[model samples]
Target: MKTMFKKHGPPPTAVEDATFRIRFAELSAGYAGHPVLHQLSAGIAAFTSTALVGPNGSGKSTLLGVLAGVIQPTAGKLHHAGGRPPAFVPQRGAVGDALPLTVRQTVEMGCWGARGLWRRLTRQDRAAVDSALERLGIADLATRQLGELSGGQRQRALIAQGLAQESDLLLLDEPTTGLDPEARERIAMLLTELVADGVTVVHATHDLDAARSADVCLLLREGRLVGQGHPRQVLTPSTFARIWQPA
Candidate 1:
């Protein structure tokens, strides 16, 4: 299984000229008979930062899951600018694998998802991994074991792992959950840099500040789009009140 994704890994296809961005038309996703995302249609422009916002159980994470290809949409088309697979960073605690590995080793594992086993990482691969660590300002922490890192440091390491993959599209879920305000700011700054480098980022978060920082904000409610556009337009106080009415 591992060897197949390495030597015979999917070919690197160029971005299409005609794609305005990634488009999902009439998309619906859910399990069994309950739909988590219903008739969703959104266009995520290439290299832009789009944020998903909603109250609890509003399907924000479910939307990100669909974008990351972790969950298949029950209906509609999802078109991308390129054929490249996306890098996914689910909520902080989604992955809890105990590997007894250092931060650097863990970050390098990003390549393994696509690079597979048997084939050694190339010089370019190593450089990408190093650059990702440097970008996250965790170069010094590289040799430290994952078990020894703080929550913020571990989160940064996971993001660095995503950066190492160098996927054009990145999907993150609640990226700054357990971090302090300072760390949160740092992560936001790093995300800005990633956007500048032409990476399209779509993430889910309940953080109001993070929502404000996004180029586009999508508000979800009961598997429906409450609003889709700028933060000011979508995150009005009234909208919040409606989404999370008092029980």
Candidate 2:
């Protein structure tokens, strides 16, 4: 079978279009009857990198889960302009580290959504997994058990899994957390490359630097939208103080 992983060249220069890939209007969601995201409203641009920034318990993860369709909103509406399901990579802590799986095997799970369980992988599916491993620089560790790798290596493998899914929209939650600077940079660069290839990326993070690197930034506090705009505009010192300052 022909490979589904078509190599798109570098990301195209961004146009000044206001086209949005997803829109959340007055969205509210939570777990166990406790509201986490309150009346949140934002638009994620198509083929752009967006950083969801906020303090702990501010509903960043909840919002990301909603975007990825893993969680349903209790109220309000979410419209996907692209109408395609997104590939979601939750935090490393959320993943099962003790699973007896190799790096390649873990990455291959990304293809499950397309191929389904109990079905053998096609040549295209295998190709996509190989491509993702190479793209994430984890080919050398393909046979390595996920439990044996360092935090950074494990994170890369998870990211490769997300890539293998071949989804146009990728949602990640704190992918760079606990990684060293080099690993963080590698992940960031890969995300930029993905954006260049026309993949819309929305990652929830506490790293201010990572947030600043994105084309758009959405600030949240106490499950509410504090601001949304360019990084420089939305991440002002005052904004930081309001979110991180001890009450």
Candidate 3:
């Protein structure tokens, strides 16, 4: 549940090369018997930032769950480049502050995947946690209680947890949902840097500006792919109006 995807099964009929870090063909998933993603076919290019843009309830979070291997796809073929579990950073609010976990302790949990929950962390694991905190500029806040931090700081800590996982793929859900402009910009910049470092990133966001900055955009409507490509090409004014206009 902490990491990964249903990547088994014969390849789908759709032709795809190694160019994409993730490939899902006719993928469908949801809670109980209800489907949120309807045979959605898409490819996420390696080492690039992909923005999942669509109106609410367009299966964004469900899709992330599929990619993270937390949700089993009800149907379709899904694959990841390395078959390794991706580090998934759920929305900050999704993580309850009542746990009373310290920042460093929370981040160290990312290592739980490599080592079981009750196992003691090795020196390397501790180093990875420390490095993740430093990378997110939260080294000084490592000992702070998660509930005591500001919105932006808390978000950084959550992201640091993902970073500590050391996965080639990273998935995030609305990382900038309620942040101020400056905080959003900082997280956005960090995402760009992660891509440069060769971690394929896919995030669902309502921030149209953030979508525009992505290397690729996947537009969804009614649980289906509507368009995809460079943000400028796929997120044109007309497209936005059509997708976001009042129902």
Candidate 4:
């Protein structure tokens, strides 16, 4: 079966100056006959942070999975300016506790995108892994088992793996979920740094404060996009009532 996402030549000239990192139209998905996203259409601005906010079952994770190319979308038209796919970082607990992989090994997995899984890491690849570890502030825990780390540490490690992928776009599914406030703030700062480095970041989260910090906010309601614009405008009091409460 063909995936909904398709990499193509450069975006058409008309949208070049429009400043969108990614754009999609009529996207839909399902899992075991259960519909997720509807015919959703939206665009993520270039080099900015975007937050996907909605109540449970709003299809945030599904959309992120579509963008990441891990989950096949039943239908959609999509294009990314980067040409290459975005790096996806799942939540901390996604990695199993039983895996014998160390932190460094997990981070090195990011290089598989650039270097094949069977290929040995070059000097540059090793450098990238080290750089990612340092950037995530987990260089000291390089030898630790993934399950041995705290929730925040594991999350950082996952982000480091994405950083090692070195893609222009990033998709994180609730990266700050279940973390201490300080840890959440730290991860938020790291995301800001990624944007500063010219990386576009998209994250689905329930943290309204984090959503407020994003340059763009995508409000989802029952798998449909309800709003797209500055956070201050899209995440409004009245809008919250409409999406979170009974219709």
In order, what lDDT does every prediction score? 0.81, 0.88, 0.88, 0.87
lDDT score, candidate 3: 0.88
- Candidate 3 lDDT tens digits, 1-247: 1222445455633345468788887788889988899888888988999999999988888898899888888878777766458999999889999998999999998999999999999999999999999999999998999999999999999999999999989999999999999889999999999999989999998789999999999998878888899998989989988888876
lDDT, candidate 2, residue 69?
85
lDDT at residue 102 of model 3 (Cα atoms) = 96
The per-candidate count of clashes, in order, stands at 0, 1, 3, 0
Which regions in candidate 2 have their CA more than 4 angstroms from the true location? 1-18
Backbone clash total for model 3 is 3
- Between prediction 1 and prediction 4, the one with superior TM-score is 4
* Selected candidate, larger lDDT, 1 vs 4: 4
Give candidate 4 misplaced runs (Cα > 4 Å).
1-13, 16-18
Please give the range of 10 consecutive residues that has the lowest summed lDDT in model 3: 1-10
- Model 4 per-residue lDDT tens digits across residues 93-168: 6779899989999999999988899999999889989999999999999999998999999999999999888788
lDDT of 1 by residue, 130-229 (tens): 9999989999999998878888898899999999898988889999988899989998988888899888988899898988999898888888887888
- Residue 19 alpha-carbon offset, candidate 2, angstroms: 0.8
Model 1 spans > 4 angstroms off: 1-19
What local lDDT score does residue 187 receive in model 1, on the 0 to 100 scale? 87
